[model samples]
Structure formats: C-alpha cells, structure tokens
Target: MDQSYKKIEKLKGEKLIEKLFSEGKSVVAYPLRLVYLKTNFDAPVKIKAGVSVSKRNFKKAVDRNRIKRLMREAYRLNKSNYFNNIPDQYAFMILYIGKTKTDFETVTKKMNTLMDAFLKQQSLPKP
Candidate 1:
C-alpha cells in the first residue's frame, strides 16, 4: 500500500486558498485553526493540504519546523478517520496559534482531541 501524503496533488495556490476559506467552514482550537472548504466529488479523498506555524510565537526555524512536523504527523495518522464519513471533498488549512513551543506528543494529543471534538460537534457521519 502507498502511505504517501505528497504535497504536489495538494492545493497550494493563493487564489484557491482564499476561495476555500472564503467559502468553507472554520473551527478554531485556540492554537489550532482548521479551515475546511469541502468539495463536490462523489468519492472520498482529500485532494490537498497545508500546515503553518506562527512566527510571532517562536522565531527559531528549528522550533517552527518541529511544530509543523508534529501537526503533519498527527494529521497523517488520523486524517483517514475524518475523511471517510464526509459526504464531500475538502480543501483545508491547519494553523498553529500559540505563544510558546510545545513537544510533539503534546501537540499531537491536542490536535487529535480537537479533531474528535469538532467532528462530534459537526455531527459528521461516523465511520
């Protein structure tokens, strides 16, 4: 099985990003902002994705990279569960908004917790 989460197929254009956010739904988890604009595809598959960490919080490149990596990993492991039940497609962004650096495990736990709570609140179909 291919376990790849490549970026080439993910939407990265500024226009698309703007439109997705403009037309989609948003859920803020304080330090984690999830803006999702679902698509009209008949099948279940996430087309594109992106991650961003706040420079205002941690100015160091290493710290930013670490946080981004943690978020990506959490998404990679748990995204399929979120994608399976949704009726439409999604173009989304995960934004980190915090004042201090965090460990990977802590971030992952928080991300997973936030996702579960959001999905439950949305009443998205369960898998």
Candidate 2:
C-alpha cells in the first residue's frame, strides 16, 4: 500500500468538517481523539483525514504546527495497517488534546493504540 499522504487524501471543505464534528462519533486514546464519519466523497480515496492541535493548549502557532505535523506523520505511517481492509469510505479528524509538547515516538505509540481502538469500535454491532 502507498504510504504517502497526498493532497487528495487530505480532508477539506468547511461544510463537511462541520457535519463531521456535529454528527460523527469519536474514539479517544488519551491525547489523541479521532472523530470519524462514514460518508461518500467525490474523490476516489478510501479515507480523507485531517489533523489538529488546540491553540488553547499550545498558545503559539509554532507549537501547534509542530504538533500537527507530528500527528500527521504518525497517522500517515500507521493508517495503512489499520484501515486497508475497511470497505467503506471515511472522513477523520484527529485532534491533539494534550497540554504539553510531545515526541514522535510517543505520538506514534498513541496513534497505534488509537487506531486499534477505532477498529475495535467499528467492528461492534449497533444496538
């Protein structure tokens, strides 16, 4: 599978983002929270994902940007293993909820845990 995160796979559009947060369900693994929605897209990609870091927590744009970059890299490296078999298209927003700065190893470990939780949640039957 391709490991590159291309522009087409980046989630965009204000309306879609609004709908995702308003209607999507979430899976949390400590500092990382993944809010996801199952939806169709014009693009052919199986998943569209975006990453965010809270301005309130980081205070500086430099800090927030670094965290977002780390989160995105972690997601890019891990997503293929967890999501390759999923049949439905999904939109995902990954938010960094921690207050302090973090390292790449920590981010990658948490990302793996988060993806595992997400897959487990997705496999459960609805009530």
lDDT of each: 0.72, 0.90
What TM-score fits each model? 0.80, 0.95
Looking at model 2, residue 70 earns an lDDT score of 94
- List residue ranges in candidate 2 displaced over 4 A: 124-127
Question: Which parts of model 1 are misplaced by more than 4 Å?
Answer: 1-3, 40-44
Alpha carbon lDDT at 123, candidate 1: 82
Worst 10 residues of 2 by lDDT: 118-127
Model 1 / residue 93 / CA error / Å? 0.4
lDDT tens string, model 1, 1-78? 133566553557887789887897877766788777766433335446788888888899899998899888887777
Candidate 1 structure, TM-score to reference: 0.80
The ten-residue window of minimal lDDT in model 1 covers 1-10
Residue 87 in candidate 1 has what lDDT?
Answer: 56
